[model samples]
Target: MNKLFKLVRHLTMSLFAMATLIGTTANAERLLTENFEYELGNLYSQGGWLKYGTQAAGPVQVTNNALTYPDYQDKAVGKAVHLTQVASGEDLMRAVSETAISSGKVYLSALVKVNAVADDQYFLAFIQPTSAGIVDKKTPPENTRLIASKGSVDGKFVFKISRNSATLFESTEEFELGKTYLVVMSYEFKEGTKNDVVQLWVNPAVASTEPKPNAAINSATHTGADMKSFQAIELRQGSSATKVGPEVIVDAIRVGTAWTDLFDVASTEPTMTVTPTVVYDGSAVAIGSSTTFATYAVEYANLENPIDVYLTGANRNQFEVSAETIPAGSGKATITLTYKPQAIGKHTARINFESTVSTLNTGFAATGIAWDPENPPMIVAHSEGLTPFTCKAGEQQKQTITVTTSDLPDYGKAAVKGLSNGAFIISTATLLKNGNTQINITFKPLVPGDYEEVIEFSGIKATTETIRITGTATENGTTEDREGDRLPLDDSKP
Candidate 1:
């Protein structure tokens, strides 16, 4: 009975250990992954990707048609984030995640393809965030705790971990130019000095049946502010000289608790579908004038085998096609189409969608209005002079001039001049009941002199009118002197 009891106890202990191992393996989770499989042309950010770069650095290009890396040549793995400086060596390009991480021993990995590597070129593949919003490389925030960077320094590839403006760890491994490499970084957050740890693995063999980091090229533990969490990350690249313009392509980026999840690839071909057949409003557009239509969206099914959706239309120049490529796992994408009337008469175009398996021909119609500036309405004066042309100089005098036209005012401006020491005001410049535009001009004289003014009426595409005015200002009363002595205006007194 004692031997049987011992055997039972041994079996129970073995079973418990196996269960614990299995549970540990199942607990691993992926925190974030960005494959760049979607076509986000001209978009600054999507799916929480916020691009950051040096003051004049070009934005990162998210594309899926790169053939530089043959290993990821297919669309499934072909999509990548292309980063390059704008011919300025001092420029940096980076795309940071909107999500923030505060705690955990997180693993970050990505497949990076260096199209051209030059001397003194630095590329920071993963950045541990310290604060929210945008993280600028030129002036990193004070809370910035750590950064993992690699580059070709002194004609050799080097990996480094930096903390609080200090280099914590660096690797001596060398990398080749125009080559694809898998990089993995593990960051363990802890409180107090010498408690936080960071490790890096280059060309990690995570895709193999037995997945693991190739080898730890660099590792370090440093003391700083309590290492609590990271708010964002970025893939940054820059150079030290204006002549060295290097381009880096990255794909299959993953952040998780373990390195195994970084190998996740698209497994199926998505089904494509567009809904409701976008139809722009059928309206008349004026020639040399533009109108914008409402925005619309396109929907598709997520698939493993990536497909390209091309939006083409007849008379492409007249219409602007703005759309983002449907990502590998996204079910919907929005497209904004704008049409500008180029010529007069009816304009018809077919906006067609071409995909791997289907095509949608969207019919659009618009009418263009012919606008001739030379035929625009003209402005004419009701009469030549003011109603009352004469006024007393010493006593303020007023006159009314009625101007009529059949055109809209040109920026609400009617130039009036030749009123010397006199004031003029337009009480009204509006259309009358008979379809004619009437402008009421009032002029007041202040000093005795021949007052004259030219009023011009102008409008868009309309022949304007220029009118001349004549006015006289006389003394309010006359004083006469018989023998060097002035007399009052009353003739009797004189």
Candidate 2:
């Protein structure tokens, strides 16, 4: 009797362990995978994707311009979807195999490369389906939105997250344009109402078992109805006027319940090697001045297989490359870059090298700044002088002008001239400080007529600056109309 009881206990434990293994495997199932492998054309009606939005706006296109990132599971798979925001554009959606995912957490991952982004808008999202497997256009989906906008730094952009229509939670780290990044979003469906959570991870480590998020949004504070289930994943090309969505290339979209399901365990080696992954021209040149030429070497394992090189970014026009195509015979080639900035701001761009024989791709960042130390101060008039400042006769109107200078220990003076009529009274001359200074200009016109004057600022370290001020004295009550225009401060003069 004792032997029989022990055998039964062992068999029961074995069956329980097998059931647990099966359940764990089932939880890691991938529901959707889209590499956009199809003929180069419209993405609608291809590979079970359907078109929505305004038909006249046209559908997103599938291009052979595929993108690859380091360690991405679906590196350089078939093709990619090109989404460009027009005046109005059509959006596409593909229904997932498991339409009703009510419980557990859902993970969405994609490899995205932004070419251009004008304003803050969402480019990708997911929506719940109706009984007939159709998305409800009237209701906003509990989505994993990828929002892009101009970064605080010039010539850079940042990504943000928005769950449903909640406020956006943006990332502080700025990203370079024309670079591929792996983005992962997870949506957690709580048991209660209005308690769903969404989190976003940008460029997370694929090899890590648990990856943390860069930004997140919760439905409790943002206030969005809890989603019952998610049916389809969408690529939105929002209207240029309102949405102003970004122009981006999207690839390697995967939807799963676990993080490991979205990434592959095996890794491939890079075909080509690039020296100095980040090419930074740290020299601060004056506006319109050119920086010293710099070169980046691209060496390939196979000499016969060449690579194509290109530049893309907001400040890409400021840079010039020596060669576009690296020759096949040469095992390595040098590409020179020259930075000649026209504007007085930070300039940045990216240089992408794509291999001809393999899916291996890499890029380097280039950055520079243009500044004028001699003429670092800026003068701005806060009056309605773009058209004319208007005031009634026998009334005094005051306008404030601010002079902002860089943190340089330079002292200067300013004076007003071209005041023919005694109607205009100017403030006393004072020495300019290194920081901001406020100057007052009072217009007390006794007669009802038009008047003009000029404020000349001199004795500064750089060139002499001037501001043109005009005013109109009306017979009726005073009125302040039109916004003031800033005079172009010449930064060329030493």
Candidate 3:
């Protein structure tokens, strides 16, 4: 009797993941919509539903205790099925429909109120055989696609999608307690690499009492093989089958061919929105050097799901994208462009964003300037004669040093190094560019001592220039005794 009980338990759990829905309704076929009005004493086994496990271990039943408040209770259309798994073993309560979805595209709609979620649970549309036996969760049958599921982690609700034994996508939105969510999953599968598509939308029709559903969320083309046919819709829990699992209420389940038939509101076509149609490099790009032109946006309107926009055209190679797969309901994504010229001349390139819905291209302009090897630009400036400072033994005094450059296209970076041992320090160095360039260097004292340093400018087309910095600090004393106590504003003035 003990061995027989374990075999039944394993075989019962393996019955899920099979069966298909076929034949289409001219309008929308309501595949299965159950609002349990009758008692559910043995409903899990008798109502065209085949389940795993006994009533003593666990059972799925309809109850009024699942929803009692006025808000969700009225919308529930009376009693709802409470799905639970109390056994320490695998437990599943699933119904295999007579019809199978033969089409590559289909829609699934369900109204679910999450009472509690422990770890992971399945509210799935998948393709699996109706054979008897138990299948391990780690190694489910081949082509077992979990089209959609509702789960929770760390006290937040989550939507999960799995295909070919791997997770394809998960939603970031968290569900609220006692609130009902109308989840709609729409999918179109195609054979190829990253061609199958999946999308999830929550709460299409907002009841007068409940809040709106989360915006649409979609996944990138799954990286695996295309799913077979839609076989079954299941509400199965994972290892959450223990007594610590969840108490969920499922109602108003529907499957159809068209979005209009499944959802109260009709689906809208996807629209593409691109920002800053033109991109230009602020200054002329040097030949053999690259300059970033602009950072712009590509957005979606009316479409709640995520999709990929393939980039194309002449200058597409010059641009680099951050991410091609825009997340679902993100509404917008960003792209950055860089101009790297090979030859010296004026150039223009058109780059385009192409997706299933729309294609948008923008023209970016760049001017390449060649370097003049013979007459290189030079930095011109007068160095400070000497910098002097007087302060307390541990106090610090700030000094400023400036460098000016003539109009030139070529520029070099400025660097300052101190010669004193932990006595002289460079606080800040700022380079400002107008028609000319001005570099400001500030030095601060660290201790009572005499110090000297040098500022070096290198990498210019012309010869490098070095400026000397000298300072002296003494004990804090009377003002009259400090002759050269402060650093001069402009030492070169005298």
Candidate 4:
């Protein structure tokens, strides 16, 4: 009887221990782990990832290289994805979770190597899932955005974080190119509206069970709309205006509910190698007219067969490409793009050269603007060719320049050239249609000497005009403002 009782107790204890282990494993499982273990090619339609936004934006490609870091569980496991700002590279998104994560904090970790940095732009973000189908090309509510920008020191780059679409919180230290770093980001969903917070860590120790108390960057103040939930993670290449890093490679992307879920285990996961696409900005043309705005020559090498070309975009109808197909050869062909705008505004589209050999396929961007001929956009400076002013050293003198515009409203941007000593200050102004605006120009000289500045005013689709400002600064001279005679109207194309 004693032996029987002991056996039963041991069996019960063993079952309980097994159940506990099972529960812990389920809780620690990662929501998503992607190492790009697939064949080298386009990232689209691979491993459940889909392309979002304008098709003109080329697809992100999987490269042959792998990124690794010390103590990273999935270090150097599979291939990596390359994102480039060259010619508006593609944007991709994959569902991290089937259901939206609303309450608990979500954490993401990745290995990133920035090859180059340009203008500030977000390269990675989280988006809410949609039952209506794949998320629209129009950007959704971005929760935790990872941004990149030029560093304070040359030849280096920095990482930044943004909650929703709010201002970016940048890292204090600049990161170098060709060096891989482990980046971790977490988003906490607060109970109230607009109270959520985000934190970013660079080179955090993977073995640590919890995130560091002091993150490299944090956004305590929330801006933009509170994300109800997030289900997908997006890789953004950004546009020409909001250009991202020139070349950025990412690998070992893991998403989880807890920090331990990301580092405590190892998992296996899942490329195109495409050349950089071309981007062309066409000059503004008048409405109701068609113009061959730009032309590009696409070269096909090691061609297996003939390739077909296709254009895709909302404004694709407004643009026409000359070549529908390219003959199989190792030669170059010139492709002409014509833009005809039925309505006035800016139009953009993409021309893709498609072929069975994916590497041989290439594309170019086509962009043009259409404006009304009668009321063409124009801004004129109604001032003298050379305005002379007299001021004393350490004294500031102010002058006003009258700016008139045609029937179209224009935003005038003022730039002072040939002076970098803070001697001249110019204000930007918006000129209403068929109206006039006054732009204030201030001249303050520190040392008594002669100063000259050429102020240039530039507007969209408008001809640029320049005004030469000459000033004489003396130790005891009284401030004097003199306006020069108005010049004749000059018409020129922008």
Candidate 5:
């Protein structure tokens, strides 16, 4: 006991010094335990030990140093919880093993303090029983028995479960063969309201009667084949069944290993977010790496649900993304996202870049479009899908005419008439030019009829078409007037 105390104090001082040396800087240490392995992690659990159950109500805790449990009673003789009164679902618990072991009589010893009470609740136990076998507080197998009221040890319940069964072939009991148990304080692990899984180690007997040990199951992988121990634990019973009630607190759980006890919850790397917002028209964009780039999955979702866009498609980062880790932190690379316009006129695209790093969020852009109309242009009007225009013609009337045109080579002389036979016309078209002005006309007939006047466009493009003016007027008297710019038809002269 003297040697053990000295050793623990030394280890604690060493660890605290190391922590102090680190100050606020980052550091990494590789240690492995039973349930978890870092593939890559840096998790740390602090303090001395964890008590799976709480220190409240049922399975009530006494001021005694060691937490004791009897099955709750039909009623309480005192506040000390007995097995029966503890209610249906409470189970007493404590941490069984920190790291796994390979071999021996697994000893679960605790400095227990008990009061002068005699009942079935007095048996020392383990919430998570060892693979050897399960021993209920009520039934003590051969070699094991319940000790009566020596409970007041140095004025507190400080007791221990000495050892588990020694030989594998023999009837099994819980703890390991060679290991020792030394619990100094009381603490609790309050992750959840669930009852803890624990194993109880009673007072160990003398050496000569010690059970045999299995070579492989007695130790750790580093020690020998028997060096590895499988210390997996689970609840023997819940708050309800089998008698023991809840409400117990155990602390300072320490197990023996070839090496000193190491507490770690460390992970390899911290998560980060990288946003490369590029404005590229004739330029290039990429997710470059000065080191191995964390392959974060980028999302693009203007169309529907957000989609994943990789570093390869950097130009379009517009959706949700999953982050990838860059382990070594050195080999950087870049991913490029590109977008090119197909047509003109207000081309719009929306993009969003989301990352686990909360700081780099919302990448957006609103750019201007540069469009030039004609180098060798076609000046055709844009497709007006459906246009409404007024026509002097009656509704639902059909008319026909033959039309031809000459592509106008000269503007000063009557030139190409771009209009076709289907073109609309004005009241008159006798091309009359004065100064730089030329006359152009258009008209819509109310109904199909025989009608005529003149059609011309001087110094401009024109098309000639044969018309069947119907009003029953044939070869109607007509005259050409080199006349004034206001020439109306001279029907009176005729």
Candidate 6:
């Protein structure tokens, strides 16, 4: 009787083991693995991964395994990988997974962050759908799909999901068993997107449980990386394919079960219908005190047109406080936004803001923010006095965009229209440290006909500055070339 019972127990154990193996195989698809260590090693460690050299490559300062950007705040607007000065390098890995995928499909993802900008172009390679390997050189978009979108014309990063698909997942890239590509790329998005925000979450797996968002938002959660190099991981036999070669790094190499569920996102991210983040300052604008002759207005613009964002401001009524000066400890100027006579108890009114940043004699209008007195105060723009030089019947010259805050009562952000013409190209719109934001308006007449370059500045008020220049196939003229009557207001009045 004892022998029979033992035999039965042995059989049951074998059956259970078989079941466990089958279950394990079934659950093996939802994983992400790699050979690259996640670390901040010097050149000796990080290899191949690109760098968006900020002050330096990061692995910024860390304590207790925490990493943070020390000097990450920048105004450039391009999304790039920030390299802290001391940053020797970073860890980027390729594929390796927990279970073997016979059908050869895998779900892949990674952690992404935007320092002060968005990404231009970034990709991830899932190699040899049948075996484990890496795709070294970048393949063309026709050959590989893009899993992420770069920054748009405005500025910001976006990650959305579609039905059974994600926001920006491409399938052009192949998938190899046990192999994953550790890509280092940045991403951004257009501004004015409704309900837009950014954050980080450590447990990516847990993010899927949240309520269904419009689409699959990759950034639903992201946990910043720990500041140390991850250690190499142990793998099962055959894990290292028959061919083993090349310098590779690995850290915190955790194994996962990768299940291919056909994450269907379009071939590319959307075109970005929103604006950029150039207009959000998170604070009300403060106008400065009015100097005697310098008049104040709810709107002010530069003298030239062609430029959209005119050098303008809000809060007219004429304000009088501590002249124009940045508040102590603040990196930006803190002029008084108080322009209303009723601005009494509040000590100061919360109004007025920079519309156009005039520099290089050009009007750099804010991207998009219509004026609103009640909701969020805004200003209008108009043209200034001086514009670009132009041509006449046979004389030749170029048009320009200049700011004219040199005098008051005649100032507001300058808004130039119809200047995006084929003839006038914007060369430089230099905005010095609170200097004249000049826009070098380069005008090239298309034909031999007489052309009138009307540089109109419009914001709160409207003014038109016209320059007539003739186009000819032959180029013969110097800065001294002239033809029609010259407007003393500007030398380009041909």
- C-alpha TM-scores of all predictions: 0.40, 0.48, 0.38, 0.47, 0.22, 0.22
What TM-score does prediction 6 earn?
0.22
Q: Global CA lDDT of candidate 4, please? A: 0.72
Q: List the residue pairs that clash in candidate 2.
A: none
- lDDT of each residue in 1-494, candidate 6, tens digit only: 25796467446646754664565443333243322333433322233332212223233121122112211111222122222212223222233433333232224333223222122222222222222223322221111112222234333333322111123332122222112222211122213322122111121322212222223223323222111111111111111222111111112222222212211112111111112222233222222321121222222223122212112334233333334322222122222222322221112112222211222112122211122233222222223544444454344455444443321222334322453345544454222222255555555654444333444332221232333332333334435758998876756875
State how far residue 53 of model 2 sits from its true place (Å). Answer: 2.9
Summarize candidate 4's per-residue lDDT along 434-472 as a digit string, tens digits.
568788888888888888888886766677788877787
Model 1, 1-494: lDDT tens digits are 25796467446646754664565543266766666656666324455554454444466677873433223223455467776754542323233334656565667676666655544344553454444444544333322221223354533344444433343444446676566766677766655554556666675443523344333322334344333555455555453446443467767767776555555544233345555334445544455665555344555554433434333334445556565344655567765566665543344444444333322223333222223343344556666555546767655545555555443322334677545544455555443311454566555666676777776666544566677766677766755446775655867865
lDDT of 6 at 45: 21
Model 1: which ten-residue window has the lowest total lDDT?
Answer: 140-149
Query: Per-model C-alpha lDDT, please?
Result: 0.51, 0.72, 0.51, 0.72, 0.28, 0.28
Tell me which of candidates 2 and 3 scores higher on lDDT: 2
Q: Candidate 2: worst 10 consecutive residues by lDDT?
A: 133-142
By summed lDDT, which 10 consecutive residues of candidate 3 come out lowest? Answer: 16-25
The reply for model 2, stretches above 4 Å from the true place, is 1-26, 73-75, 135-142, 168-172, 266-494
The residue ranges of model 1 lying beyond 4 angstroms of the native Cα positions read 1-26, 53-56, 65-75, 87-99, 118-121, 125-156, 207-228, 239-246, 264-494
CA displacement after TM-score superposition, residue 456 of candidate 5 (Å): 35
- Please list the residue runs of candidate 4 whose C-alpha ends up more than 4 Å from where it truly belongs after superposition: 1-27, 73-75, 131-133, 136-138, 213-220, 265-494
For candidate 3, write residues 1-494 as lDDT tens digits: 25796466445434421211132233555555555566755445444555443323445666774343332234546566766645443334343345545456666666666666654445455544434322222222333223223445544566555454454554546766556666766656666544556566666543312232233223444455655555555555443334344556677666655665554442343466767533562444555676666666777765544554434445445445555666654367787666665543334454445433322223333332333333344554455544455566566666555555432344445676656655555533433321334444443555566777777764334466787766667755535646656875977867
Query: Which stretches of candidate 3 lie above 4 Å from their native place?
Result: 1-26, 52-56, 65-78, 85-97, 123-127, 130-155, 206-221, 240-245, 263-494
Looking at model 3, residue 376 earns an lDDT score of 49
| Candidate of highest TM-score | 2
Poorest 10 consecutive residues by lDDT, candidate 6: 230-239
